[model samples]
Target chain A: MIRFVLACLVACGMLGSVSVCHYMLTRSPVTEPPTSIQPTLRSESALQTPHRTPDQQADTTVSPSRIQLQNNDAARRFFLILTSGFNTAPDPFALGSDGLTEPTRLSAQYGDKSIITLLNDLLRGESIRSSEFDVADTDITRGTLTLFIRATPAETDARIPCPLRIDLIRADGFPCDTYTLWTPGNGVMLTGEATLNPVPGSNTAALGWELVK
Target chain B: MIFRNIYWIFWLHLLLNSMIPCSSARAEPLFTVVASTTQIADLAREIAGDRCRVISILGPGINPHGYMPVPNDGKTVASADLCLQNGLHLEGKNWMATLVRDNGNRPIITCSDGIIPLHLDYDGTVVDDPHAWFDPRNAAIYVNNILKGLIVMDPEGASQYTARASLYLNQLRVLDAWITEQFHQIPPEKRILVTSHDAFNYFAARFGLTVRSPVGWSTGAEIGGGMTPERRRHVVASIREGQVPAVFVETTVNPKIIEQIAQEAGVRIGGHLYSDAMGPAGSAGERYIGMMRENTLTIVEALSR
Candidate 1:
């Protein structure tokens, strides 16, 4: 009789604990939007700065910084084209045998922590590859847009120099050349819409951004 | 007797807990949006995210220009929280508008609202072009209009809609950039787009390409519009004069005209571009972006060589 009473109580206790834990875990979903790309009607300054200093960019665990321009109302859209050594990853601006743009291929060819790796990471971010947009051209121009580009150091060991040329194109259509980036703590940031020239920022040797236009 | 009842209830609680755990049963979506065309349907789906359900009255490759609502289409919109249509007379003879009107005064939103329309001379009267989604920037406007309608219907999902709209807008920007870059390969002299009708004006204007189509194309009141001898002559002249290496057939338009033009012009048929509707399911042009991507690829390959 005593054992039967204890078993019932034990069983009841276990059920209660399971319910409480489940409630706690399920109720608190990750509802907050990532801080980098929150939409708001702000001054152009927000698009102008993106953790240029190394200390400000030490944490690479979160998503790369994505700055939105002007009340999240964008009249023109832009895409970045990367001209690197990887043949499989076709330059978006170039014509190849096939009609498809080969996706980015990332190997430790530069020891995952190098600038090239960081570039690949930025290009492969969710924002770069997401397919939820069905945008059309607009005639009503929004105010001047402050371009924000964030470059963070990827965790890699290889320090080999990778020469790369980068160009920027907006949806309205145009291109520019020449670029420069200041280095801090082995991290580099590129801003502006039309062109990008990367000056070596960290330990990687011979890493340069060429004018590819 | 009371003790026996207590034991039964305890086991029942355990059984119920095992099945449901901590999550409550999910309710039906916040609301349902019914769009007249697949393109607008996709826009609503993009903005709605997982918050609500979106249904398109017409299926893939069904020309919106002359879509006649079936029996089920009426039932489909009957349960809709909101109705959407591509205004500017894309819905041949106002078929979609008439359908929505009979749906009992639902909050109908013209997805093409706020677009600075591209007007074409139709029957001696200038009318706005209906195929505005071709431009990535205009696509942004369409998405925003849909977002606003959704927000009005379900205020609580405004942030969700806005956030999604931002992501989608960014994507549009990327697409626009990519399309421009792809077109850069074609020499300026060869940057001409020849299609069955005037559906690609916004796209060509947005990018650095020129579009040439037959006269009375802007007023194509029927799908795969009947080709007149004069219109046929215009198409052949456009191809020969523009030195267009290849012309494209349309998924929704009658390909017979394009095929005859391609043969008459002595140019190879490049490929069929998705204009009035996206490709059938499982095809490259299944989604809006997919359609654009495939269309650009087709155009690039045909024109570059």
Candidate 2:
């Protein structure tokens, strides 16, 4: 009878241990907490910048009503023809500063490195000091550049704009200056010399006296 | 006995973790994604690879500027889990917006959202022109963004998408190098490139081609409004003074204007260039590389001659 009572006491102890283990397992700490970031609330000033928002300035940066210049088949054709047929000689104003003296410094803006090189070559051909020609600005909205040329009182704009001609280098690498007139009035005859020379470091140019009209 | 219990518990925990659907549920989807244009569609296909069924509505020779999506096209976009577009108002806003409205749940990824677009001169006014695909480098970013979307949709396929994207990026690198090499064939002085539309500003800027065009970039605008007679006269004068020998035509745009210009200026129409879309399957311009190679060769041959 004494042995039986001892066995019961041991059984009670074992049950107590099991209950403790169950409680420990059930109350285990979280293994994996969230790794996500907590969003911070922003102040009103933080949300609003002093500068004008794009939406607010949308009206000032209005898009052209007619965006595609190529949609007009006739106009496109004429543009191609004019590009191909027009003489591409360097504008005499591009050579001289004020139509009275040859430019000693020149700057051209064209994104294309090749066009920049071509412009440089053309300038060198005009006997403009090679050091005078440098790429002032090369990034335009498109491929066109607003170039500036400065003369150092070396040569006079002796020839009028009519006598001055610009020779253009074609995309195909051919020299183009004049083409057969396809329109009325012998299209684009130079009556007298016209000049176009930009101020130093500015896009604004002095319109050389040219009589294209 | 206590040690044995502890070991048993660890084993049971591992077993449960392995048997659960943790990996399978996270597996990404693999559907072929088709696009409307090769520029964007090609990018999507590059990102999707074996995971998606990629197809384009506008194949080689097709033009997105004037593409008329058919009934099947709407169905295709509507059913897809995700649809991709070039969205700078590229695919006429009307049709694209309608498609988006129809497929409310499906995500329509715009590839050109962050790109700096080229502005064109339209009647002395500046506007954003939406032909961003001409530059292959910009296309690389487009493909990357597509991969982002694909990964979100199918996390399991993220690795596959990444692999395919890298391969496509390598191809674009080769394309860029090839364009530079091809432009080298023409004498530096003869590298003046003029097209029927202002679609080539990006190409010209990237490849060092001097371009002149009467038309600005987008084809969605009115034809006669910006292209005034005065501009035509100026262009004619430029042609007479400039010695441009040949002009180019885009595959999708009507070549009538180019032809008229050629006739008037006595210059040859170089050839049709693939600007907006690739050729149909089994054609020379069906794939991205094929289309770009064809363009390079056309420009080279035309200008080199």
Candidate 3:
């Protein structure tokens, strides 16, 4: 009787172990590690290097193939092309003291550094010029760069010097004997020899930046 | 033995059933479209409905003229099946369009196609005025171009696209008539408009208003300097000369400049106008029609005196 009871207890123990092993074998293998472990691993890797924001990464990792116009010659040519395109009496609502407003001085709105960066990016490659750049119907080839200027009282005249010289002619392609001259920086000086044509249906004129060298 | 075999078959059937959903999920197809501006994306969505996925490169308040394309924008373009842009150089140096072309040479549709483009002649050079959609009739042309492009890309949905486009076009015609009637209330002499920039030339031409601004055709061109003394004197003189009852600010431009001019001229600041971009999602100018209506109402209220 004692031997039979012992045998029965051993058999039951073996069956329980076999059932547990079978269940374990049939269970699914985890495709992903536990969520708790992922954060710890990420933290460990993150500690190995400094974190970089997306913009910083973009600024640093600009592709080598991407063309940039960093030279003074390119910058000067770009400024001339940009300045030549302004319409005489461009803004209909705002008339100059002469009853015609030439293009607003660029140096007054943007800093030299900001303007240089924008021109460098836009005029980086030869193919870039074929692309049209327009704003509010005015075609421009550059991007916006924000920089601080000497702030003055709203009513007072804060005449910041213009960056480039521009010349304007009449719609009939005649010399209006009107021109604007200014020297912004980098030893760049414009003769204001360029002429502007009237944009049809608008009081403003259009500058052909593509025709500029 | 028979009972054990039956139990094994039942488990096998359960496992096979569980795999069906996973297979179907992987089989679903997606048609991806890339649009250059939010207005284009909205139009694409109206036409595509749930049949395709649409993404806009320029979001609300982003000036398409001065927009710079990043590396991620190129990646997005590479994954797109079709691309759309408001052509005639509306992309500000055509940067957005060029970026798309450079990425994959994917099929790009210019929504401004087939419209009689307004040209601006500066000196001897003639350039196309790209802001044609300010007029509802031009907006119809945009829809037609978009419809044709969609049909060419996905002929399977031609009938659906055609139906949606027809409905939208009818609504545009109605919107155009409504604009005409709204402007009729304002006297012809009172139709003089002064705003932040020259974006309203097409709008003014369509509605019979004389438009003026201190800034050039583009706000991007205003970069050389802030308000010059000459420009300020010019605008203030024009306002006084025209006896322009009010001056308006644009939603996309800085109002400070216009405000200063209005203050100097002693005229009330008219309500904000939407140019280059539409208003936020819940605003009155959210949709194309809504934007036109809001703009017309604002103009009439300010100038109707």
Task: Tell me, by DockQ, which candidate is best.
Answer: 1
**Model 2 accuracy (lDDT, Cα):** 0.53
Q: Mind giving the per-residue lDDT tens digits that candidate 2 earns over B113-219?
A: 65678777665667666777777766766776677778877888888888887777657755765687678788876776767777788888887887776554555
**Residue-wise lDDT of candidate 3 within B19-73, one digit each (tens)?**
5545644433357889998778877877776667888887776777678898889
Model 1, span A15-87: residue lDDT tens:
9887886777567676887569676555322322242334322321112221222113331344344443211
RMSD, model 3, all Cα superposed?
27.4
> Of models 1 and 2, which has the larger TM-score?
1
- First chain TM-score, candidate 2: 0.18
Error of 1 at A190 (Å): 9.4
Q: Report the poorest 10 consecutive residues by lDDT, candidate 2 chain B.
A: B219-228
Query: For model 3 chain A, where is the 10-residue window of minimal lDDT?
Result: A149-158
How are the candidates ranked when ordered by DockQ, highest leading?
Answer: 1, 2, 3
In angstroms and one decimal each, the interface RMSD of every candidate reads 12.5, 22.0, 22.1
RMSD, every candidate, angstroms: 16.6, 24.7, 27.4
How many angstroms is residue B258 displaced in model 1 relative to the true structure, after the best TM-score fit?
0.5
